[model samples]
Target: MISQLTHLNWFSVLCAFIPYFILGGLWFTVFFGNPYKTSLGKGNETLPNSPIFIAGPAICCLIITITTAMLIYALNVNTLSGALEFAMVAGIGYLVTNTVNIAINPNIPRPIFYSVISGTYHLVGITIVCIIIVAMK
Candidate 1:
């Protein structure tokens, strides 16, 4: 594990992290702002402009990027095909499922709608992350 960490390309991880984080910003705000708000039952009401909203997701994306990097190194995934396969597995299995699970609650008025929006964001984000990591490798 330690050896794999040393072998991991830190630069590639950063490169991957940037786009994933950016995608989340765009996904939640620019692209699906109204839909997202509606899903939360906010319906045009301004959501809290708390720093935690940004900081929390940034932290999560960073952790995800680092973990993906480690897994790519440890699993010896070197090809584009391998990266895509890994992305699909990780994206759908972990990210999409978790997003859906979180959305299926009383807080979200439109749980399925919220899940579709958030889950797809994560799926695409993970795909980008995996592709960047593998290409840079």
Candidate 2:
């Protein structure tokens, strides 16, 4: 793990993190803004333009990108097929599941709908991160 960290391509990690973070912004605000708000029972209420909303997800994306880069380097996943496989496994197993788990609570009015929206964002975001990490290897 330590060796993998040392050998990790910092450029690729940055490249991947940027898109993942941006995707979260666009996903919630542009693509599914109305639906996402509905799922959260917010209705027509405008989302708070809080720093935590941006900073929190940015931090999460950075950690996810770095971890994905490390795993790609450590596992020697250079091929597109290997990258796709790894992305699917990690995306579905961890990212999507976790999103769904978090949505399944009293706060979210429509847990399944919320899960599909948020979970899919994570799934696609992680896939992009994985591919970038492997391609830059």
Candidate 3:
């Protein structure tokens, strides 16, 4: 349903996706690949095409839905309140994603180094966009 973020623009859809796209790319291609391979207990075998084969699509879909919903109500709704709600929902999503990663890789040390920063950067970006949407009106 929610496919874009533009109505109220509490947080631009493109901006939201930027962090996810970049961080996800790095995660799967670089650092995460190694850990993921080890977790699967397999060698360097190419991934296949299936719902479970590539999980990134599901994640991306989530990001799009959340931001698009935020945008849809931003204009007709209260900007500050909407922004807060958006932030909370998005922050929760970020936390859940990170926590899930840590849960999967229990051995990884606490306090994610670069990945945590990546999420924080995304939060800051969303916050800025929220502020911009409020101020622009």
Count clashing residue pairs per candidate.
0, 0, 0
Runs off by more than 4 Å, candidate 3: 1-6, 49-59, 62-137
Candidates 1 and 3: which is better by TM-score? Answer: 1
Per-model TM-score, in order, reads 0.96, 0.97, 0.42
- 1-137: candidate 3 lDDT, tens digit per residue: 24434344444444444555465556555856655544444336765557663466546544554554465354443477776666556655765466446545645443354345445545554554454444444
Indicate which candidate wins on TM-score. Answer: 2
Best candidate per lDDT, number?
Answer: 1
What do the candidate models score in CA lDDT, each in turn? 0.94, 0.92, 0.51
Cα lDDT tens digits, model 1, 31-99, are: 999999998999779988999999999999999998988888889899999999999999999999999
Q: What is the lDDT of residue 13 in candidate 3?
A: 45
Give the 10-residue window scoring lowest on summed lDDT in candidate 3. Answer: 1-10
lDDT of 2: 0.92
The collision pairs in model 2 are: none
Query: Can you write out model 2's per-residue Cα lDDT over 1-137, one digit (the tens) per residue?
Result: 86788998899999999999999999998999999999999978997898999999999999999988888888889998999999999999999999989998998999999999999999999999998988888
Query: Lowest summed lDDT over 10 consecutive residues: which window, candidate 1?
Result: 1-10
Q: Please report the TM-score between candidate 1 and the true structure.
A: 0.96
Error (Å) of candidate 3 at residue 79 is 10
